[model samples]
Target: MDDIYIILVASLFSISCGLLGSFLILRRMAMVGDAISHAVLPGIVIAFLISGSRDSFEMIIGAALLGLITSFLIEFFHKKANLQTDAAIGVTFTWLFALGIILISVFAGQVDLDQECVLYGEIAYVPLDLWITDAGLNMGPKALYVSAFILAAVIIFLSFGYRYLHITTFDSAFAASIGISIGLWHYLLMGMVSMTTVAAFDSVGAILVVALFVVPAATSYLLTRKLKSMLLMTVLLSFLNSFLGYYLASTINGSISGAIASTSGVFFLLAFLFSPIDGIWIKAIKRNFDKSKNTSKTKFNKIFKE
Candidate 1:
C-alpha cells in the first residue's frame, strides 16, 4: 500500500512534467527547464522566511514567481544584451541557486528546510504528508492533489491552444505573419514549465527535475516527428518509468526519484539505438549494407570487363 501511494504520486509528477516538457523540447528550450528548476530555490527560501511556515500556499506561489523571473532574465540577456541563450540560462540559474544556498546556510537552524532535500529530494516522505479533511476523511498525499491539478491544467491549456503552439513552435515568422501572438505563446509555455517545475521540486528536487522534463519527451521526440505522436509517447513513457522505476528502487534500496530518473534515461537510450531514422545502430547497419552493395557493383564491373 505504501509503494502504491508512492507510485501514484510519482505518476502525477511524471505526467505533468512530461506533458509540458514536450513543448520545451520542441522549441529547443529544454535548458530553460533546467534554469527554472534551479532558479525557483531562492524564491522558495524567501517565501519560507516571510511566511514563517513551511506548509502554505505562499511558498508555492513565491517559487513560481521566481521561476518566471528566471525566464524573463534569460530572455533579457539573450535578446537585449546579445548573450547566447545557453549563457543566459547558465548565468541566471547558477546565481539564483547560489543565493538559495547562502540563505539556507545562514538560516540553517531557523528553517525546517535542508539543502540535501532541496537538491536530492525526499520523495519517500511524500506519502507521510497526508491531507486529511476536517471531517476525518483520508484524502491521500497532499503532493498528489497539487500534482494532479497541475496535470489537468496543463492538458487543458495544450488542448485549447494547440494550434497557436504548433504554429509558433515550428515557424515563428509564419505565426507572426498570421497575427498570432508568438510572445504570448512563448511565455504561456514558460509559465506552464515554471508551475510544473515548482510542483515537482518537492518530489524530485531541482537536479532530478530535469530528467522528468527532458528524458521522456526527448525519447519520444526521437521516435516520431509528429507532434501528436510525440505527446502520446511522452505520456506513455512517463507511466512506464514511474511503475518500473518504483520496483527497481525497491529492489536496489535506493532513492525512488533517483531510480525513476535513471529509468527514464534507460528508455531514452533504447530509443536512441532503435529509433527508425536517427538511431545510431540503425545508421551503422545501413552504412555497412551500402558498403557491401558498392563492393558487389565494383566486382561485377571487373568481371564483365574481363
Candidate 2:
C-alpha cells in the first residue's frame, strides 16, 4: 500500500541517520548534519549542470564531496584559525548555502529546480516515484531502495570501524596516542552523513533529514549510557517516530515530514523530562527524596540525644 511504502521509506531513512548521528552526538558535532544538509545545495546544482540530469547518483556524488569539504572547512577553521566550533560551523554553512542560492539564481532557466522543495521535502510523494523495471514490473518506490541501501551501508561502516570510531569519538587524544587517525575517521563519518543526507533529500527534505540525524540519537543518548544500547534504542525510536508521524499527519491532514519531525521532538521532550538515567524530573525527585531522608535522620538523632 502507499501508506506502508511511505512509512517504510521514512523508517529506513531515520535508522540510517540515527545510527550515524550517535557518533555525531558523542563528538559534539551534531549540527554538522545540519550544515551538510544545507551546504550541499551547490553540489546538487553543480551535479545537475554537469550531468545535465537530476539523477540521484550524480547528485549524491556531488553532494557527498561538498559535505566532506564542509567538514574539513569547519575543522580547519576551528583548529587552524582559532574560531569557536559553533562560529566555524555558522560561517561555513552560511557561506556555502549562499553560494548554492546564487548558483540556482544564475542558472534559473536551465536548473529546473525548486529550492523550497529541496529544503522541505514531501514524503507523501514517495509512493508515486515508483521504480518500474524496463519490462514493466513495479519494484516499488525508488526512495525505498535508496533508503535501504544507505541503511545497509551505514550498518556495514559501523560494524567494521566500530573500534576506531568508538575510540576516536570518546578520546581523540588517546586514539591519537595509539596512532589512530582521528581526521581520517572524522571525514569518513562525515562522508557517510553526506551520502545519507543526499539520499534522503528527495524523500524527506534537508530539514527532516537533520531531524532524523539528531533527534532519535539524542533521545536514545538520554535513555542509555552505553553506545551500543543507545544505537539500538535509536533504531527503535526511529521506527516509532515514522509510524506515529504517519498517523498523526493523516489525522490532521498535515505534511508527513513535518509530522514526523514533530513526533521526534515530542519523543525527545519526553526523554528529556522522564529518562531514568538523568532526566530533569527524575533528578528533581531524587534531590527532594534525598533532602527528606537527611532531614529525617537529623530529627532521629536529636530525639535520641534528648
The prediction achieving the highest lDDT against the true structure is 2
**How much is the lDDT of residue 80 in candidate 1?**
99
Task: Tell me the lDDT of model 1 at 160.
Answer: 96
CA lDDT of each candidate?
0.89, 0.91
Cα lDDT of model 1 by residue, 116-224, tens digit: 8888687898889999999999988888888788889889999999999999999999999999999889888887887777777878899998899999999999999
The parts of candidate 1 lying over 4 Å away from their true place are 52-55, 294-306
RMSD of 2: 1.8
Model 2 CA deviation exceeding 4 Å by range = 298-306
lDDT of 2 by residue, 80-168 (tens): 99999999999999999899889999999889677876777888989988889999999998888888998999999999999999999
Q: How much does candidate 2 score in TM-score?
A: 0.95
Candidate 1, pairs of clashing residues: none
